[model samples]
Target: MSTPALQHIAAVGAGRMGRGIAIAFAYAGHEVALIDIKPRALEATAKLETESLAEIGSSLRMLADLGMFDAGELPAIMARVRFVGLADAPAALEGADVVFEGVPEVLDGKRDAFAFICEHVRADAIVASTTSTFLVTDLAAFVTHPERLLNAHWLNPAYIVPLVELSPHPGTSAEVVDAMKAMLERAGKVPVVCAAAPGFIVPRLQALIMNEAARMIEQGIATAEEIDKATRYGFGFRFASIGVVEFIDFGGNDILYYASRYLAQAIDPTRFAPPAIVEQYMEEGRIGLKTGKGFYDYTGVDPDAYRRDVLGRSLGMLRHLDLLRAPGAALRPKE
Candidate 1:
């Protein structure tokens, strides 16, 4: 028999990430309450939630048709969700096993949101944050139950992506950590325990590479599209499977040394040197992947074309990597 949905899941701030996360829990058969500050925001969230769920349901049907799932399960999964607002958040979470806070990235906002939640939630409910940067310990300061507040950072579009870094505050109890792990595992996520730090691990690593890529483009060393293409086609595919160190080992240290030394010198390596916001997007003229132009053109191109192109390349790389790593497949245990 399939696992039952998480009885009660509370999600605050039904914006992009919030809506996606709420839908993820709902899709997994949990009843979700999505809270927002404004009524209009709540309305928008509900509409987006419907659209997201429909798209997700269609995808699941495709998988089932391909023999990935038995017949007639997706609808039942969709049926298990509901949404609410801040005033109702506490009531909805009365006996909630887990509460996922996807509030604004700002510190004061999250503190207030959690403070309100702490007043309403049951003592046993494990309050988890989907924060990208704010320190968990700091966020926990607003709540009486710091031990229950942990950072469960899910990659964008949480459903499809499997990596979730579960970083707990210093006060978080072992039981709370384990409960959070079990909750995510039941939802089919690959949860990694990480120490609480700025950007945690994946974000920190990705930002480093992405920052360098941005600097290269800004300095006219390469176009934004060229940098992205090179990264994805050249090392991106390989790194997904083998990881950096393993890829270095496979390529032999000599070639690695040469590339690192040459590339490092060619590009700025001040490390977080270029300001983040300035480098986040390409120059106004260089807005690729949007406005029907970037390094490529999409004036008359079907929007879905981009998705198909990306999916094709990514899936192929993943398939190849899986085959290569099958013999040694296992989770990396935390130190």
Candidate 2:
């Protein structure tokens, strides 16, 4: 089925994630309904509505103060989001083209939320769980139309983060995934699809990095401040220009193979041992740019041009960080 125009958006649960999602869509000029699905006393519900809007307004004002947009537009953006209590959830959800389930991560909570959401929303309305813990396949059991359900894992501070990882189950429809991608693209989000897996993409990669960083601290290798500085200026700087796999390809797989072997012996073999693919690549001579084969094929690519492009990307990052300087300029004494 063709994707419907996602003009109306709803975020159920009215929590931190839901508020973030609401602001993200509202910031992109879409009208959003921030619905609190739990039944509560009238006063409690009213208080929650007040708190949700207050936090959203505070975030918008902070963004405006940072020159992200004119302060004048805050009113318009804030107005685009409405707080709906449990009694109004059905009406709010029925009109949504996309419904993001942002309820707590507990299995029972998610099951009930999905059941209530599916009961209210149109069958074709995209039902995406902003779940960081559960797999899309697991949540699909709670949803009525499994094909229309998927996991959209948005990073914290979701309004600013461009990435939204879309994890679809085996039964999820291709059309549904395509439609969700289109909807996110329209909202200026970078949506990448991945199979239903633990931790999705960014989380999976980041968890390893975080654990290593913690291990370094535990081993007294570096202070927290020193590690963060190194991450910002060294590790993150290069990565901002190229992807991890691309960096391996550019540097040569042999480098990784040797380094991994050394680290495995020097530190922990379980954590540092090279995977089978790296060993296979080393044996087959698919080293990298030098060999014209690696994680990415470089067979048709011009070697010199590709190197120049990589250099350009690094230079662009240096310029962005204001670290690029003219040759011999630093050596010259200031006037």
Candidate 3:
């Protein structure tokens, strides 16, 4: 039997991240109480709620128009997300199964948010800080129950993005991580656990790639349009079919080893040199797919079937991008 949806979900900080997270949970068939950390007069709170709910309603309508659900379901979906002002946060959070604290990026702001959260949230509540700025360790000192705290780094437009990067510190409970994973999965999210490192996963990798893209432009390696085109047709297309490390294995680690050496020598060794693991793998005869080993073991896998599946995925991407053509079509001159 499938797990039942979470009983109570609360998102603190009714701003963009809070609103997005609230919509995501509400769309998953749960009512989410969205509370703003900022205090205001009753009239101001009412105004904020009115504007915030309007935005939420419009966002839901936009999603519906995109065929996320029925267009007519907007009212019902919007009704699931209720806004709570600072005055009502304690009562609103009393029984919350999971509380997402997305107050702000500043350290003082997080400390204040946690102090408020711990004072009212139930002892068993799985409290998470939806912070991309601070690691779980950074905020743990402010929490009453440090084990309940971890970082649930949601990408922007949280309702649409499927991935949520979960970073847990050493003091975090194993069960809390599992519970968060299960809860997120039940809400149709993909959760990947990573160490409490700066940039987590996607951000760190993208930072390097994005900086390189900018550097290429600065160096006049390619025009902006050409760079984007190449990325779409070549770099992005290839990675869409296989992961970075997986691609290394599929293409043979030996290729990267030599290419790295050549680039290091020709351009800049500091920038292009391969990590020690690559050279060590080559020395150990664990080169790649042909050698039956590399970053991942392929001992029991059927090579031909894997090859076909990868080809099919790559072809699918090309087909989607409208770049697929008859074999050797590029080789023939245009009429």
Query: Best by lDDT, which number?
Result: 2
Clashes of each: 1, 0, 0
lDDT of 3 by residue, 55-167 (tens): 88988888888888998888888888889998888999996888999987989998898899999997778889888877888889998878877899999899999999999
lDDT of each: 0.69, 0.93, 0.89
Q: Quote model 2's TM-score.
A: 0.97
Clash pairs for candidate 1:
288-294
Better of 1 and 2 by TM-score: 2
TM-scores, in order shown? 0.68, 0.97, 0.92
Candidate 1: residue 16 Cα off by (Å): 1.5
Screening candidate 2 with a backbone cut-off below 3 angstroms (N, C-alpha, C), the clashing residue pairs are none
Q: Answer with 1 or 2, whichever has the higher lDDT.
A: 2
Off by over 4 Å in 3: 1-5, 324-335
Candidate 2: RMSD over Cα atoms?
A: 1.3
**Reference-based lDDT, residue 97, model 3:** 83
Task: Quote the lDDT for 68 in model 3.
Answer: 83
Question: What digit string (tens of lDDT, one per residue) describes model 2 on residues 1-335?
Answer: 55577789999989999999999999999999999999899999999999999999999999999999999999999999999999989999999999999999899999999999999999878899999999998899899988888899999899999899999999888999998898899888999999988989899999999999999999999999999999998999989888899999999999999999999999999999999999999999999989999989998999899889989999999999999989999899998
Task: Give the C-alpha lDDT of model 1.
Answer: 0.69
